[model samples]
Target: MFHKVVVTLLVVSAAVIYADVYEPVYKPEPLPYYFNYNVYDDYKGANYGQQEKSDGKAVYGSYTVDLPDGRKQRVDYTADHYKGYVAKVSYYGKAQHPKYYGPAVTFFNQYGNGYH
Candidate 1:
């Protein structure tokens, strides 16, 4: 039994290593694919490509912005992260935009400095 356990661990470790689990692989299919009610997070983005209501305060956006090629980005400043379509992704260093300026769903994990 002890030997079996060690062998299992080795196999699992090898599988995990071969799978490359420690990288931020960004897949474009989710951004480029069309959105519909049924497809859901079946793609990417926190929500199922649908904007959601947060309690009674924040309004969020569906997927982070997927800017079309050759367009100016307009990133909205969240708690500490900037989000929006690639076209609307604001890349201003140290620049921040109020969450209220954007839809509420984008606040899925909006928090920083002192708040959750």
Candidate 2:
């Protein structure tokens, strides 16, 4: 029985090695032949032979202008090419009021900088 088991193991190992080294691989078909299924042949422009485009108007533009006071003014505009475009200006920067003490800072200076 031990001799039979040893013989079986040796046969399996030799068969695995021979199959791995002697297997035959089939070559892949050409690219053009693979697309000859006749399914996409009836599709319109399926082969990408035609170019299509529509005449559409895209009127959208914006520009930012830096003010002399270290602020930026972003102007956005839009219109049709046949008509006209309109733009509005916007300002962004420091506030018109003081930063720290606000309006009370002026009164404090006038009263000798006293908290009372």
Candidate 3:
């Protein structure tokens, strides 16, 4: 009877230890669950700035600002293996459309050509 009790106790303790060490697998839900989300903030009376997602390879981000004169200003930036780092600021709802400054200028301001 004592041997039977010891065997049963050991079995129960092993099961408890195994259960404590187990981890459940994680699975993400599908995209359709977010169909009612706020996708963009570009409309009138809406907030302008938002931070977007980034892939594993690149550090990517974007933001928008509503100008006082009814135009919208947007800035998109990224840093990765290909570009190192780049930023672009632009305007909308106006006649002026500026060009993209090259990455050299951006690098100069950030690190001063590696000397700073």
Highest TM-score against the true fold, candidate: 3
Between 1 and 3, whose TM-score is larger? Answer: 3
lDDT of 1 at 112: 41
lDDT of 2 by residue, 1-116 (tens): 99999999999999999988985688654232111112233344221121222224534555555444456666666555566777766778863543566454333556477663
Candidate 1 wrongly placed segments (more than 4 Å): 21-26, 30-81, 84-116
Best by lDDT: 3
Write candidate 1's Cα lDDT for 1-116 as tens digits. Answer: 99999999999999999888666577443222222242324255222123333322233333333232323333332221244322224522343444564444422344443322
The 10 consecutive residues of candidate 1 with the worst lDDT sum are: 78-87
Q: Which TM-score value belongs to model 2? A: 0.30
The clash count for each model shown is: 22, 0, 0
- TM-score of predicted structure 1: 0.23
Instruction: Give the TM-scores of the predictions, in the order they appear.
Output: 0.23, 0.30, 0.36
Q: Write the per-residue lDDT of candidate 3 for residues 49-81, one digit (tens) a residue.
A: 557555556666777876766688888888778
